[model samples]
Target: MAKKDDRGREGEERAARYLEERGYRVWDRNWRCPQGEIDIVADDGRDLVMVEVKTRRTDRFGHPFSAVDRRKRERLWRLAHAWMRAHPGAARGRSVRIDLIGITGERPATAVLEHLEDLR
Candidate 1:
């Protein structure tokens, strides 16, 4: 894989571990459908969280979370519903939440990370 791709994966791994450490039960990683891929799918309490992880070596352009614009967030919601539908009862009556996890720095383990919940 390209260095950037590898770094991105590393960031995702870090994010997944971070979420798990915070008491979130991770259901899936890199979940995909026709719409697109969800970096992580984890549950907190009764809500299903669809995570979008953005990683960069630095915040030269902007914060990693800044990459997820409003349009991208909307797309994430669509993908989240698609995943829920495919899983049948997994999301029955439960709320679906969109989350963004941004990791900055080459070493994701020690990188600065931020988590934003409930985009919409």
Candidate 2:
């Protein structure tokens, strides 16, 4: 695989570990269904979170989270709706939240992680 692709996978893994450690139950990674890919799907018991993970090796370009723009938010919203519809019980009366996981570094140990909740 390409170096950038590998870096992204590593970032996602780190984010997953961090979320799990915080008592969040991860439902899926790279969950896709025509709408788009949700890097991570998790539940913090009270709500369902659709996570968009932006991983970068450096911040020279910009902060990783900056990559998730308005268009991306729209797609995430659609995907979240589809997910809830398919698993109605999972999201019954529960709020839905969009999150951004910003990761920067070439390796997990050197990475910086930032979690932006309720992005939508």
Candidate 3:
């Protein structure tokens, strides 16, 4: 795989560990529908969180979170609903939430991670 792709996969793995360490129960990784892919799907007790992970070797352009623009957020909501429909009662009474995990560094395992939860 390309170096960039490796970094992204590493970032997702690190992000999953980060969330798991914080007590989030991760149920899915790289979940996809016709719309797009949700990097991570987890339950944080009260809600189902759809996570978007963006990894950058450096911040020369901008923070990874900047990639998740308003249009992207809207798309995530659509994908979240699509996932719920596909999974039936998996989300029962919990609300759906969007989260962004941004990682920047040469090594994703030791990269600086910034997590923005409950994105709007």
Clashes of each: 0, 0, 0
Error of 3 at 12 (Å): 0.2
lDDT of 3 at 78: 95
Candidate 3 local lDDT, 1-120, one digit each (tens)? 898888899999999999999999999999988988989999988899999999999999999999889999999999999999999798988898999999999899998999999999
TM-score of 1: 0.96
> For model 3, what is the C-alpha lDDT against the true structure?
0.94
Tens digits of per-residue lDDT for model 1 on 5-92? Answer: 9999999999999999999999999998888999999999779999999999999999887888889988998898899889988898
Q: TM-scores, in order shown?
A: 0.96, 0.95, 0.97
- lDDT of candidate 2 over 54-82, digit per residue (tens): 88878999999888889888988999999
What C-alpha lDDT do the candidate models reach, one value each?
A: 0.90, 0.87, 0.94
As for candidate 3, its clashing pairs are: none
Best prediction by TM-score: 3
> Which numbered prediction scores highest in lDDT against the true structure?
3
Once superposed on the true structure, which residue ranges of model 1 sit more than 4 Å away at CA?
Answer: none
Q: Which ten residues in a row have the lowest lDDT in candidate 3?
A: 87-96
Model 2, position 82: C-alpha lDDT score: 91
